[model samples]
Target: MSPDLPCIVFVRSFLHKPDNIDHTEHHVRQETPKQIDGHTHRRKHSSDSEKTLTVEDWATSRENPHNWPLAKRVITSLVVYIYTFVVYSGSSMFITAVPLVMQELHLSEQRAMLGLSIYVLGYGVGPLLWGPLSEIPRIGRSVVYFGTFVAFILVTIGAADVSNYSAFIFLRFMQGLFGSPCLANGGASMHDLYPESQFPYTLALWVAAAYCGPALGPLLTNSLVNNISWKWTMWLLACMSGPVCILLFLLPETYAPTIRYRSNAFNTSHNQNNNNTSSQDDNPLAKLKFYLVKPVQITLQDPAILFANIYTSFIYGTYYTFFDAFPIGYPPVYNVSTTTLSLFYLSVLVGCLLAVAAYFTYLSLPNYLRKHHDNTSPKSTPTHTPPTKHERHLIPAIPATFLVPISLFLYGWTLRPSIHWIVSIIGVTMYASAVFIILQCLSMYIPSIYPEYAASLFAANDFCRSTLAAGAVHFGIPLYKNLGMARGSSVLGGVSGLGVLGLLGIYYFGERLRAKSRFVERLVE
Candidate 1:
């Protein structure tokens, strides 16, 4: 009942178990309506309870999200990976074939880009619903994700079947709306499958999966279009969603709190059987309904919650918008085709790998600091410095804060239509490295600060970033045509340089800002 009880309840829940807990026995549950995170809740050994309770298997654990017995966690990750591929294929896969769509629909270049825009719009809005929906029991995340994606497939079919251009865009928007959950919920799945210590690395691999879809999207869709037709792109994606839907039934519920609540129910009921109570109670059904109906409210309604999310969104989303400028701003100026363009995306993958190195490099900091402290300590006693945010697990997005613009300037000026594609590729490689670093930072930062609502917080950010990226795509081509490629790219480069500066200012001021935020301050304390 005390204000601090949520934290206490959550900690106790993680460190201990419900075998040692019961509905009639819990002081906290009686007074506080909120349940602790199930993942954090550990079932302790006790004479009364025989249930071998663990949210995840102890052997594979976080060491390998990929290493799960192919049947359980790995299958879930792969199926979710398939969902990601479908969602992104709806975006980038349509890109090369935009001319085909425009020809059929009688739309202009800018207008045809709307399909891609609509898909991204889904990426923005889907999270608000999906993230909260995933946390609720009975109606677990996998169900919500599978159900919405099936709906998305229907919407995709509608887009394919539409005769009217206006109706087409509208249907595409609905597709995006349903598809957004994959990205928002996918991150949560990655976390559920991995541990905090392995989170950064596993996250890097997951990030690659999400982006890999975009990179590989064109290849797969191009082959599809080459053989069949562009209209079939959506059709193929819809077809793929079917198998993924089937896979969801086998996907174990990874939401920790929900897992714990169910385990408790199983135990309490079985124990009741042992006690020889012969009764059929309506209350269990009522509780099941209660669990199903519970909602997580994280709307932009609360001023404090809104500002924290929005502020984080802007700082993070700006990078996404900044990177979207890459393809049109520099590639064509260097005379790269859509087919060759996929080569450039490899940089993001490379950056993701580097980010793993950077993260482990960071994980070593505590050890390094401890050693330094030991050497410098007084003989009789030891005094140590509290790890600052900068020095602690938050590693500087290495080589990126500088690499982005340098890559930009190199590609911008040197990239003439006549120049070899390699020059621009090299430039893009740097920019990709920087962008991937930014992506890594944003991904890790969201979860690090708001571990409970990691999906929602990132969902809030996806809207900001996706919206800005869509807006930039709308205006970028026109700006470049009017202003000329070199100058246009120069202007963009200058703005991006400013973004890097913003990153610096944010990194320096970021800790202070979070320290001041009542939500985060409360969490950290």
Candidate 2:
């Protein structure tokens, strides 16, 4: 087959049903060799040579993951969250050892921080590779999870055993690269496994893990490092990886096209006429090119994608910026022990819990008001609708937009030695709460807006977030060191203040922005 034919065929299939397309007959295609016995491969050939197959339905289809039993869906979601938690912990676990690694390896400050800086750089770059591969019909999401989990486990163990600084840096980078698939595509998996109505609550939990893991990582590492050794941090993380690998294998594939292609009742004339496999099977480079280009295209083309990315990037960058800002106030003026400082991080966790509480509380208001207003009309049970474009707007997070800067101001101003340490911690907790609210809101809105390309949309968001945060960390530490904590944090707060405009822009004009974009328009349809 010609190189362009694969692209053309894919576009045609995507835009129309297989039966409607003149050139292709729809029948079950055994795209994956390792089928799940009766669950995956159920095909019946027609009396005539012609074949017919249809896409899975949203409600009735057994092949639809949304149609799975509630208990099974919950178990799958738990496994995905565990996978997310383990992988994200690897990113920040080394943070506590930054000082120790420098001392033990006889390294300079810049060189020592490279272990994290390079690892974060890998986080941004790795997904550009993983996001595309995860979408391949032949490979799918679970295969990517399985492969990356193994690589992550081995590299993490290598991190514990590294004899030299260069080896440490390389291994850390590899660990970040291998561990990034969940961060990039975990939301897409949630979209695959659950219907839209259930996504908000599900995302709240998953995103909490994503944020909480990085906050929790330093605490785990701090305890281990202070008591035993810094190297134990990597070993413990490797041990955690063992269970995640088991969980990864247990969850079956949920990517839709992959499922449809593997389903016993589905097939295509493209498979029979050309006798050629997926482009990923034939031209691996071309497949790679398609995957790599899609994220870039989405990032550039969609205004909503671009601004949502920028907003989330700044929020994430602020989260890392606080990593530096927190130490300056706590370790010096408060003179807290490493263990005590680690526990203070829990204030951020408390803030996240409060954010979750606020989310549910705010969510409940709409339901209550809607029911109260409609009570007089009839006693008929209400039916559910998929969230509309306006309903998915970031309006609910509007309260958070103002709160982040205000909390930042309070956190910065109250960090003086004259002030009580708990006062400053409280201020920072407010910052954490506001940030969590904003980040969680974007997490839900972006994926819901572009459900078809949710993984790539998330990949773009992660790319912006990780890259910006990694780049800013070098300057962040210096800012806190050169300027005093109060002044330094005020500067950080000022930057966060700018993000308010981004939130307001999307809130007011997001629908118009989405309407203007071809990619989002197509995806919405």
Candidate 3:
């Protein structure tokens, strides 16, 4: 019952700590301090009844995710990856079925495309709700992941059965809404299991799965769509998601606060006492409001984050635009069936794999080795000065930025029937690699600038990108139709070139902008 008990100290530390403080750095004394003769002294060999638990004890305990054996960690991370992949696949699986739906439902291409766009929009909105709910200790992450996915399965089933277009669109939106937690929180789950030093490696793998999911969607369901009813796409989603839902039950809660609160060391009386002393902001409704409002506020106020969101959003939109753009470019020129065209997406997957390798080789490996050397070397040993935190993230991104415009131009011009399809595939591959690098770099760099608001900023980033991509799905078809493939892609490439200038400006002036931010100023104070 004592406030000074080690378990109580750990609880209080977690409750009041900033959002981004590294969990691995937390340490608590193993012994209780006693006041004796007007001096504080450590009590040695305290009785079992008098002993208390500490963060240090928990850190080493089997319950700690960081202490989980390598196999358990890998399995857990893979489950999360599959869960994320399934959700993202749901967004694009319906793309191949668009023609069938358009013909059967008596709809325009734009109206049919709404099914996909609305789903993207749904996930964009869903994160504002899910991200905050998952942060609460009582709610935890596993509950959100499992519960939302069950809802996703039901919605997918409903979408498969619905004959009416309106009902179909609504169901698709629900699928995205229900399937969204993994997209936003999956990386957070990985962060719970891995130390900061190993996070980038795990993150790269997760991102690859995420990018590949949408790229593979058409390929996975192409035969189904071609051989059977278009409804098979939704059925395929249901089949894939149902088993993953069951597997999710095996995923233990990874959020530290939730695990700590559930432990025997956290007594009910202590919890009640802490709740009694908590501020109004600790209440559920206030917490929800803070989560919803804070992200928007931060996005608008921070110049670096605001522009980063714009640049990334445009890049994200461009990626989705290809879903529509590809059909236009490949079919007329190559005279291929839907199945063969779907095979072109393999190039995107190839690009994703290459990007992950490039990231680890050029960025992750060198930095890790440098850190390892610094830690092991003699104090007097000379070592090269390492890149600053922001610099490390920005370095690869600069070259990747240039690749985007160049890839776009190549892909645009190379779509001619005279040019071999492989040439255009190479361009798409280059664009995918560049996109992966830029997104991964900015994802890390922006959060580093304001760790306190990292979660909110991520939600903001997701919202921006998803909304733009939804629009891009609709815009891409018309742009290609009116301006023709070569001209349309050139327009996009020109815009991306402008984005390069914007990104370069951020690289140079981001620190100065951060210094001027009210949010950054408050954090410093």
Among these predictions, the greatest TM-score belongs to 3
Score residue 375 of candidate 3 by CA lDDT.
65
Over the stretch 1-525, how does candidate 2's per-residue lDDT look in tens digits? 221122211222121112112122233322221112122222324434334333232224676676788888899889999998887777777778878877887887667667767777777777778876776666678999999989999999998998887888889889889988887677767766755455567778888888778778888889888788888889999999998899898888877656755773333553463233342233445434544555577778776677778877877787777766766568888888877877788888888888888887766566556545444332323432223444344656778878877877787788777888788778778877888888777776765555445455566678888998887667777887888777777787787787777766665566566777766634313
Once model 1 is optimally superposed onto the true structure by TM-score, how far is the C-alpha of residue 296 displaced, in angstroms? 16
Off by over 4 Å in 3: 1-55, 266-273, 277-282, 367-388, 521-525
Sort by lDDT, best first.
3, 2, 1
Clashes of 1: 4
Taking the tens digit of each residue's C-alpha lDDT, what string does model 3 give over 1-525? 221223321221112221112332353322211221233323333343223334455656688787889899999999999999988888888889999988888899999999889999989888778877787666778999999888889889999998788999999888888888987787788777776567778888888888898899999998998899999999999999988999998789888667766774444543443344233313455555655676677778878788888999999999999999988889988898899988998899999999999998865455567567446533421332233446457767889999999999999999988989999899999999999999888877866666555666787788889999999999999999899888999999999998788877676666666667777623211
TM-score of 3: 0.86
The predicted structure with the larger TM-score, 2 or 3, is 3
Model 1 residue 497 CA deviation in Å: 2.0
Q: List the RMSD of every prediction in angstroms.
A: 8.3, 8.7, 8.1
Q: Model 1 Cα RMSD, Å? A: 8.3
- C-alpha TM-scores of all predictions: 0.72, 0.82, 0.86
lDDT of each: 0.55, 0.68, 0.76
Sort all candidates by TM-score, best to worst. 3, 2, 1
